[model samples]
Target: MPTHGVIRRFNDTRRTKEKMTPGDLCLLAHFYGVSVEVMALRLEDLNLLPNGNWGKLKAGGFRVREAQQQLGLGPLPAR
Candidate 1:
Protein backbone atom coordinates (compact mmCIF):
# COMPACT_ATOMS: atom_id res chain seq x y z
CA MET A 1 0.00 0.00 0.00
CA PRO A 2 1.06 3.60 -0.37
CA THR A 3 2.72 5.28 2.60
CA HIS A 4 -0.16 7.65 3.17
CA GLY A 5 -2.63 4.83 2.97
CA VAL A 6 -0.70 2.82 5.54
CA ILE A 7 -0.57 5.81 7.85
CA ARG A 8 -4.27 6.45 7.41
CA ARG A 9 -5.03 2.88 8.28
CA PHE A 10 -2.86 3.09 11.35
CA ASN A 11 -4.57 6.26 12.48
CA ASP A 12 -7.96 4.77 11.89
CA THR A 13 -7.07 1.69 13.87
CA ARG A 14 -5.66 3.75 16.69
CA ARG A 15 -8.91 5.72 17.04
CA THR A 16 -7.26 8.41 19.10
CA LYS A 17 -6.88 12.15 18.76
CA GLU A 18 -3.73 12.26 20.90
CA LYS A 19 -0.26 11.15 19.98
CA MET A 20 0.43 7.45 19.48
CA THR A 21 1.15 5.39 22.53
CA PRO A 22 4.02 2.93 22.80
CA GLY A 23 1.64 0.09 22.03
CA ASP A 24 0.29 2.08 19.13
CA LEU A 25 3.84 2.58 17.91
CA CYS A 26 4.43 -1.14 18.22
CA LEU A 27 1.43 -1.92 16.11
CA LEU A 28 2.44 0.68 13.57
CA ALA A 29 5.92 -0.80 13.42
CA HIS A 30 4.39 -4.21 12.87
CA PHE A 31 2.36 -2.76 10.05
CA TYR A 32 5.58 -1.50 8.50
CA GLY A 33 7.39 -4.79 9.12
CA VAL A 34 9.87 -3.47 11.68
CA SER A 35 10.59 -3.75 15.38
CA VAL A 36 9.26 -1.31 18.00
CA GLU A 37 12.77 -0.27 19.04
CA VAL A 38 13.63 0.50 15.46
CA MET A 39 10.41 2.42 15.11
CA ALA A 40 11.17 4.41 18.26
CA LEU A 41 14.60 5.24 16.95
CA ARG A 42 13.13 6.32 13.67
CA LEU A 43 10.66 8.57 15.47
CA GLU A 44 13.53 10.03 17.41
CA ASP A 45 15.44 10.74 14.23
CA LEU A 46 12.35 12.40 12.87
CA ASN A 47 12.42 14.75 15.87
CA LEU A 48 9.49 13.05 17.57
CA LEU A 49 10.03 12.42 21.24
CA PRO A 50 9.22 9.01 22.68
CA ASN A 51 9.00 9.21 26.42
CA GLY A 52 9.78 6.00 28.32
CA ASN A 53 6.14 5.33 28.95
CA TRP A 54 2.87 4.87 27.16
CA GLY A 55 3.63 8.25 25.70
CA LYS A 56 1.89 9.32 22.56
CA LEU A 57 3.39 10.53 19.29
CA LYS A 58 2.04 12.13 16.19
CA ALA A 59 1.42 9.42 13.64
CA GLY A 60 2.61 9.52 10.03
CA GLY A 61 5.33 11.99 10.95
CA PHE A 62 8.37 10.14 9.66
CA ARG A 63 9.96 9.14 6.37
CA VAL A 64 11.20 5.80 5.10
CA ARG A 65 14.80 7.02 4.94
CA GLU A 66 14.66 7.94 8.61
CA ALA A 67 13.35 4.54 9.49
CA GLN A 68 15.91 2.79 7.31
CA GLN A 69 18.74 4.71 8.89
CA GLN A 70 17.49 3.78 12.34
CA LEU A 71 17.53 0.14 11.32
CA GLY A 72 20.90 0.45 9.59
CA LEU A 73 19.22 -0.62 6.37
CA GLY A 74 20.85 2.16 4.36
CA PRO A 75 19.06 4.08 1.64
CA LEU A 76 16.01 2.73 -0.07
CA PRO A 77 16.38 1.02 -3.46
CA ALA A 78 15.67 3.21 -6.47
CA ARG A 79 12.27 2.75 -7.95
Candidate 2:
Protein backbone atom coordinates (compact mmCIF):
# COMPACT_ATOMS: atom_id res chain seq x y z
CA MET A 1 0.00 0.00 0.00
CA PRO A 2 1.01 3.56 -0.55
CA THR A 3 2.24 5.47 2.48
CA HIS A 4 -0.85 7.66 2.61
CA GLY A 5 -3.07 4.62 2.34
CA VAL A 6 -1.24 3.05 5.26
CA ILE A 7 -1.59 6.24 7.26
CA ARG A 8 -5.32 6.40 6.56
CA ARG A 9 -5.77 2.80 7.53
CA PHE A 10 -3.79 3.29 10.72
CA ASN A 11 -5.86 6.30 11.70
CA ASP A 12 -9.08 4.48 10.91
CA THR A 13 -8.14 1.33 12.77
CA ARG A 14 -6.89 3.23 15.80
CA ARG A 15 -9.80 5.69 15.79
CA THR A 16 -7.25 8.31 16.52
CA LYS A 17 -8.43 11.82 15.85
CA GLU A 18 -4.84 12.84 16.38
CA LYS A 19 -4.10 12.38 12.67
CA MET A 20 -1.61 9.70 11.75
CA THR A 21 -0.21 11.30 8.65
CA PRO A 22 3.30 10.36 7.68
CA GLY A 23 4.65 13.53 9.18
CA ASP A 24 2.84 13.06 12.50
CA LEU A 25 3.65 9.37 12.62
CA CYS A 26 7.29 10.07 11.82
CA LEU A 27 7.45 12.75 14.49
CA LEU A 28 5.77 10.47 16.98
CA ALA A 29 8.05 7.62 16.11
CA HIS A 30 11.30 9.52 15.77
CA PHE A 31 11.01 12.26 18.39
CA TYR A 32 7.98 11.96 20.65
CA GLY A 33 8.82 8.83 22.64
CA VAL A 34 9.29 5.83 20.32
CA SER A 35 12.13 4.92 18.05
CA VAL A 36 11.46 4.74 14.31
CA GLU A 37 12.33 1.05 14.04
CA VAL A 38 10.12 -0.05 16.92
CA MET A 39 7.15 1.96 15.72
CA ALA A 40 7.64 0.59 12.23
CA LEU A 41 7.76 -2.92 13.57
CA ARG A 42 4.67 -2.65 15.74
CA LEU A 43 2.54 -0.53 13.48
CA GLU A 44 3.45 -2.55 10.46
CA ASP A 45 3.23 -5.99 11.99
CA LEU A 46 0.96 -5.99 15.03
CA ASN A 47 -2.78 -6.21 15.05
CA LEU A 48 -4.89 -3.58 16.74
CA LEU A 49 -6.60 -4.76 19.89
CA PRO A 50 -10.37 -4.78 20.11
CA ASN A 51 -10.33 -3.66 23.74
CA GLY A 52 -8.58 -0.33 23.35
CA ASN A 53 -4.86 -0.94 23.64
CA TRP A 54 -3.65 2.36 22.35
CA GLY A 55 -1.20 2.36 25.21
CA LYS A 56 0.73 -0.24 23.28
CA LEU A 57 1.41 2.39 20.69
CA LYS A 58 2.69 4.65 23.41
CA ALA A 59 4.84 1.84 24.64
CA GLY A 60 6.27 1.54 21.15
CA GLY A 61 7.02 5.22 21.41
CA PHE A 62 8.77 4.65 24.70
CA ARG A 63 10.87 1.94 23.15
CA VAL A 64 11.88 4.31 20.41
CA ARG A 65 12.93 6.82 23.01
CA GLU A 66 14.98 4.11 24.64
CA ALA A 67 16.63 3.17 21.36
CA GLN A 68 17.46 6.78 20.72
CA GLN A 69 19.09 6.95 24.12
CA GLN A 70 21.05 3.81 23.44
CA LEU A 71 22.25 5.24 20.13
CA GLY A 72 23.32 8.54 21.72
CA LEU A 73 20.47 10.51 20.21
CA GLY A 74 19.50 12.12 23.52
CA PRO A 75 16.06 13.37 24.53
CA LEU A 76 14.72 15.71 21.88
CA PRO A 77 17.83 17.84 22.37
CA ALA A 78 16.09 20.31 24.72
CA ARG A 79 14.50 22.14 21.86
Candidate 3:
Protein backbone atom coordinates (compact mmCIF):
# COMPACT_ATOMS: atom_id res chain seq x y z
CA MET A 1 0.00 0.00 0.00
CA PRO A 2 1.04 3.58 -0.62
CA THR A 3 2.48 5.52 2.29
CA HIS A 4 -0.35 8.01 2.37
CA GLY A 5 -2.98 5.33 2.10
CA VAL A 6 -1.33 3.33 4.83
CA ILE A 7 -1.35 6.29 7.16
CA ARG A 8 -4.94 7.05 6.37
CA ARG A 9 -6.10 3.51 6.88
CA PHE A 10 -4.16 3.28 10.11
CA ASN A 11 -5.78 6.42 11.41
CA ASP A 12 -9.23 5.33 10.37
CA THR A 13 -9.16 2.14 12.37
CA ARG A 14 -6.98 3.24 15.24
CA ARG A 15 -8.36 5.50 17.91
CA THR A 16 -4.97 6.83 18.87
CA LYS A 17 -2.56 8.83 16.72
CA GLU A 18 0.14 6.28 17.36
CA LYS A 19 0.55 4.48 14.07
CA MET A 20 3.41 2.26 12.96
CA THR A 21 6.12 3.53 10.64
CA PRO A 22 8.78 1.91 8.50
CA GLY A 23 11.21 2.03 11.40
CA ASP A 24 8.68 0.38 13.64
CA LEU A 25 8.14 -2.29 11.01
CA CYS A 26 11.83 -3.02 11.08
CA LEU A 27 11.83 -3.53 14.84
CA LEU A 28 8.74 -5.66 14.81
CA ALA A 29 10.38 -7.85 12.18
CA HIS A 30 13.34 -8.30 14.46
CA PHE A 31 11.25 -9.00 17.54
CA TYR A 32 8.95 -11.38 15.71
CA GLY A 33 11.81 -12.97 13.80
CA VAL A 34 10.22 -12.27 10.46
CA SER A 35 11.22 -10.56 7.23
CA VAL A 36 10.44 -6.97 6.40
CA GLU A 37 8.38 -8.11 3.47
CA VAL A 38 6.32 -10.40 5.65
CA MET A 39 5.76 -7.74 8.27
CA ALA A 40 4.91 -5.10 5.73
CA LEU A 41 2.46 -7.35 3.97
CA ARG A 42 0.86 -8.16 7.30
CA LEU A 43 0.56 -4.50 8.15
CA GLU A 44 -0.91 -3.63 4.79
CA ASP A 45 -3.42 -6.44 4.98
CA LEU A 46 -3.95 -5.96 8.76
CA ASN A 47 -3.58 -9.70 9.16
CA LEU A 48 -0.47 -10.19 11.25
CA LEU A 49 -2.43 -12.30 13.68
CA PRO A 50 -6.14 -11.78 14.01
CA ASN A 51 -8.74 -9.21 15.01
CA GLY A 52 -11.32 -9.66 17.70
CA ASN A 53 -12.71 -8.21 20.94
CA TRP A 54 -9.22 -8.20 22.33
CA GLY A 55 -7.07 -5.17 21.70
CA LYS A 56 -4.82 -7.00 19.30
CA LEU A 57 -3.21 -4.40 17.13
CA LYS A 58 -1.34 -5.46 14.01
CA ALA A 59 0.94 -2.52 14.48
CA GLY A 60 4.51 -2.41 13.36
CA GLY A 61 7.41 -1.65 15.60
CA PHE A 62 7.12 -1.82 19.36
CA ARG A 63 5.41 1.00 21.13
CA VAL A 64 7.10 2.21 24.29
CA ARG A 65 4.14 1.09 26.35
CA GLU A 66 4.17 -2.43 24.95
CA ALA A 67 7.89 -3.03 24.61
CA GLN A 68 8.11 -5.17 27.71
CA GLN A 69 5.05 -7.28 27.06
CA GLN A 70 5.74 -7.76 23.37
CA LEU A 71 9.30 -8.95 23.85
CA GLY A 72 9.31 -10.03 27.47
CA LEU A 73 11.89 -7.29 28.01
CA GLY A 74 12.32 -5.04 30.94
CA PRO A 75 13.47 -1.47 31.33
CA LEU A 76 16.83 -0.70 32.82
CA PRO A 77 17.06 0.58 36.35
CA ALA A 78 17.87 4.20 36.99
CA ARG A 79 21.35 4.97 38.18
Q: Per-model C-alpha lDDT, please?
A: 0.54, 0.49, 0.48
C-alpha lDDT (0 to 100) for residue 73 of candidate 3 = 44
Instruction: Give the range where candidate 3 is weakest over 10 consecutive residues by summed lDDT.
Output: 48-57
Q: What does candidate 2's lDDT look like per residue over 1-79, in tens digits?
A: 2455555556664585644443444454554355454445556554422222345556645454444555566554444
What is the lDDT for 19 in model 3? 55
Off by over 4 Å in 1: 1-15, 50-79
* Clash count, predicted structure 1: 2
TM-score of 1: 0.43
Compute each candidate's TM-score over C-alphas: 0.43, 0.30, 0.36
Q: Give the CA lDDT, 0 to 100, for residue 8 in model 1.
A: 69
Q: In TM-score terms, which candidate is top?
A: 1
lDDT of 3: 0.48
Q: Tens digits of per-residue lDDT for model 1 on 1-79?
A: 3456555655686576566655566566666676566666665554454453322333545444454455555432344
How well is each residue in 1-79 modelled by candidate 3, as lDDT tens digits?
Answer: 3545555544554544355544455555554555545555656466533433122333433344464346554443444
RMSD list, candidates in order: 10.1, 10.7, 13.2
Ranking by TM-score: 1, 3, 2
